[model samples]
Target: MKTIGRIKTNILSMGCFAVLLSFSSGCGKDDAEDTVENCFGGNWAERYAAELEVYANAVSVYNETPTPANCASYKTAAKNYLDALRSIVDCVPTISRAEINASINEAKAEVDREGCD
Candidate 1:
């Protein structure tokens, strides 16, 4: 009888430990982006991807039907989008922030040089 009782207690303790472990493992994974270690987390990638799509669409539209005014507008929009990416400089890692800044500067120069040719 004593052996059976000890076995049951041990089983209950193991079950409780398993539940706690499961909960803890899931806790940080769900909020990974919000955690301090991740900083801007996944937002930088998402924002950059979205901005690229917008810039591509603008360029495509301008290319399909070129006009000086439309080209300038498209360039301006793309520049603005690229510039906004710099806002996450402090949030992202150092290497990424430098790369983003360089990209923005390079794109701005390209936009300035592009014309309705």
Candidate 2:
């Protein structure tokens, strides 16, 4: 009977420890769920910057080509990449859309001036 009592006490202690462990280890609610906009999960500016970097990379590839073979794929791919980037940037509302717009306009001008393959 005493051994049985000890077993019951051990079981209760284990249950309590499990509950405490879960609570202490952050098992209940996520920080994102607690917040409204989840700016931590990358805000509009962050997303825009990420997409813009891709655009810049595509442009770099398009610009560095000295031959038709190098120029062919990069130029075509740059257009598609730039289009997708612009769409993503446009979807996200910005505090200063003009800044992004100016940069895009500059890129457009460069593209037009180059007239590459």
Candidate 3:
């Protein structure tokens, strides 16, 4: 009977420890900031900057080539740029949507000026 009581106590202790461990480990809260910042996860501004770089590179290529294929690449990159802005607006509602849209408009103007579209 004493051995059985000891086993029950051990089981209860293990269960409590498991619960404590989960709470301390932030279970179910992993990457929670992903939603708060942007849909792609991790530093939103960095991702935005990287996408902008890609668009800039595509724009540069379009400027040199101006072929349909090059223009298509530019358009695709422009779409990605717009998508990132939208995602930022969606994920971080506290941010100014107008500012995000302004950036998008500026990028679109750049694309148009480059004749990429």
Candidate 4:
């Protein structure tokens, strides 16, 4: 049981780490300009940044407490972050789009495995 608990914790940690890594891998200036012109009326970057903050806060809360409610909140924040990232995929280069999609899908799987539902 202890080992299983550790494994779950590690999985969650990895998921959070992946989310953080994806957040860091943002678009370059040219891509950002394209994103601004194409997505959310030039506000996608700001929106994504805001969502990243919210997600970070949620992760901190979940880490501190590990409660079910906090877990649910974390999942919600993760989903929102994924959505924000997804919105600008097309505006980014193809390589970036593939990487972002992979991160999003991996994070989604992690959240699903969290079993908060």
Model 2: CA > 4 A from native: 1-65, 115-117
**Candidate 4: lDDT over CA atoms?**
0.62
Q: Provide C-alpha RMSD values for all models, in order.
A: 23.0, 24.6, 23.5, 6.0
Predicted candidate 2 versus true structure: per-residue lDDT over 1-117, tens digit per residue: 223233223323333333343233322234564222442233323323444455445545544644555444444444444453344333334543455455445544544344333
- In candidate 3, stretches whose alpha carbon ends up further than 4 angstroms from where it belongs are 1-33, 37-42, 91-95, 102-117
Clash count per candidate: 0, 0, 0, 0
Ranking by lDDT: 4, 3, 1, 2
lDDT of 3 at 102: 64
Give per-residue CA lDDT, model 3, range 27-110, as digits (tens).
233455656333445344544566667866876786677787888786677667666555555433334456555655655554
Summarize candidate 1's per-residue lDDT along 12-90 as a digit string, tens digits: 3333333343343322324544543453343444434555567556666776667776676667666656654554445
Q: Candidate 3 has what TM-score?
A: 0.50
Overall lDDT per candidate, in order of appearance: 0.50, 0.40, 0.52, 0.62
- TM per candidate comes to 0.54, 0.39, 0.50, 0.61
Misplaced by over 4 Å in model 4 are: 1-44
Tens digit per residue, CA lDDT, model 4, 7-97: 3454345445444544565544444445444544434456467777787788778777877898888778877877777666665555656
> Cα deviation in Å at residue 56, candidate 2?
8.9
Off by over 4 Å in 1: 1-41, 46-50
Candidate number with the higher lDDT (1 or 4): 4
User: What is the lDDT, from 0 to 100, of the residue 41 in candidate 1?
Assistant: 42
